[model samples]
Target: MGELIQEFNDYRAKMNDVILGKQNKVINRLFNLDTNCYAEGALSTKTKEMLGLVASMVLRCDDCIKYHLGKAHEQGVTTEEMYEIFAVANIVGGTIVIPHTRRAAEYWEELIAQ
Candidate 1:
C-alpha cells in the first residue's frame, strides 16, 4: 500500500512536469475540461467522483481507479458508498470488471485508512 502511494505520487509528479513543460497548452485545456466535468453542476463533486470511480473500474484503468478513489475519499465518500458504486460498475461492465472492482475496493480501503 505504501509502495502504491509512492508510485502514484511519483507518476503524478512526472506527469505534471512533462505536461507543464511540453504540452502546457493542450494539457491545460484538457485539465480544464476535466475540472469542469467534475465541478458542481446538477450533481456534486462527490457524486462525480463516485461516477468516475465506477467508470474507472468498468474501463479497467488502474491509475484512473486510484485517482478517482482518492478524490472520492477526499470528497468524503465512505467505504460503503464505494461498494455501492462497485455494484453498479459490476452490473454494467459484466464479469471482466470483477477484478477491477476488487482493485478499486482495495484502493478505497487504503485511501480511507490513511
Candidate 2:
C-alpha cells in the first residue's frame, strides 16, 4: 500500500479502536448503522460507495472522503466513474468542493498506485 494510504488506514483503525473501546451507546450504534448501511442491497456496494464518495466530497469531510474513496475503489468503482462522482459533487457543492476534489483525486491516485 502507498504510505499515505497505509498511514491513513493505520490511524483510522487505531482511533476507532480507542473510540469504540469507550463503549458509548450512541457512538457505537451510529458506527454500527454506518457499517450496515453500506452492505449490498438493492443498490450494490459499489453504488453505495460512489454515493458515499460524492456525499463526503460535497460535505467537505476529508476523512470521510478518503474512507469512501478507499471503499469505492475496493468495490470496483472505476476511475471514470470516480470522475463522474466528482462531477456530481462539484455540481452540487459548487466552488467550495473543488479543493476537496483535488485532495480526493490525489487520494484516489494513491489508491490506484498501490
Candidate 3:
C-alpha cells in the first residue's frame, strides 16, 4: 500500500509536470474545477472512490484499480461497499466483471488478511 501510494504520487507529479508545461493555466483551472465539483457533489469521497473502482474494474485498468482501491481504503470504504459495487458491476458488465470480480475479491481478502 505504501508502494502504491508512492507510485501514484510519482505518477501525479510526472503528469503534472507534463501537463503544466503544455498548459499550466488550463490544467490548473481544470484541477480547481475538479476539486470544487467533487467537494460540492452529493457523493462523498468514499463513494466516488468506490465508483472509480467499479469503472476501473470494468475497463480493466490495473493502475486505476490499484490507485483507487488504495484511496478507497484511505477514505474508509468498507468491504461491504466494495462487494456491493462489484455486484453492480457484474450486473452491468456481465462476463467482464466475472473475472474482475474474482481478482478484486482476492485482492480484498489479502487486504483483510493483513
Predictions: Cα RMSD each: 1.7, 0.6, 3.3
Decoy 3 TM-score against native: 0.64
Q: How accurate is candidate 2 locally (lDDT)?
A: 0.94
In model 2, where do residues sit more than 4 Å from their true spots?
none
Clashing pairs in 1: none
* CA lDDT for candidate 3: 0.73
Global Cα lDDT for candidate 1: 0.83
* lDDT, candidate 3, 4-104, per-residue tens: 35666699879878887787787789977755644526888777878788888888776667666767777877888878888887777778768777867
lDDT of 1 by residue, 1-114 (tens): 466776897998898778877866878888879879999889999999989988888899988888888888789987778888889999998999998877777666667667
Q: What is the C-alpha lDDT of each candidate?
A: 0.83, 0.94, 0.73
lDDT-based ranking: 2, 1, 3
- The prediction achieving the highest lDDT against the true structure is 2
Better structure of 2 and 3 per lDDT = 2
Order candidates by TM-score, high to low: 2, 1, 3
Error of 2 at 6 (Å): 0.8
TM-score of each: 0.89, 0.98, 0.64
Q: Tens digits of per-residue lDDT for model 2 on 16-108?
A: 999999999999999999999999999998889998988888899999999999999898888998999999999999999999999999999
Looking at candidate 3, the ten consecutive residues that score lowest on lDDT are 1-10
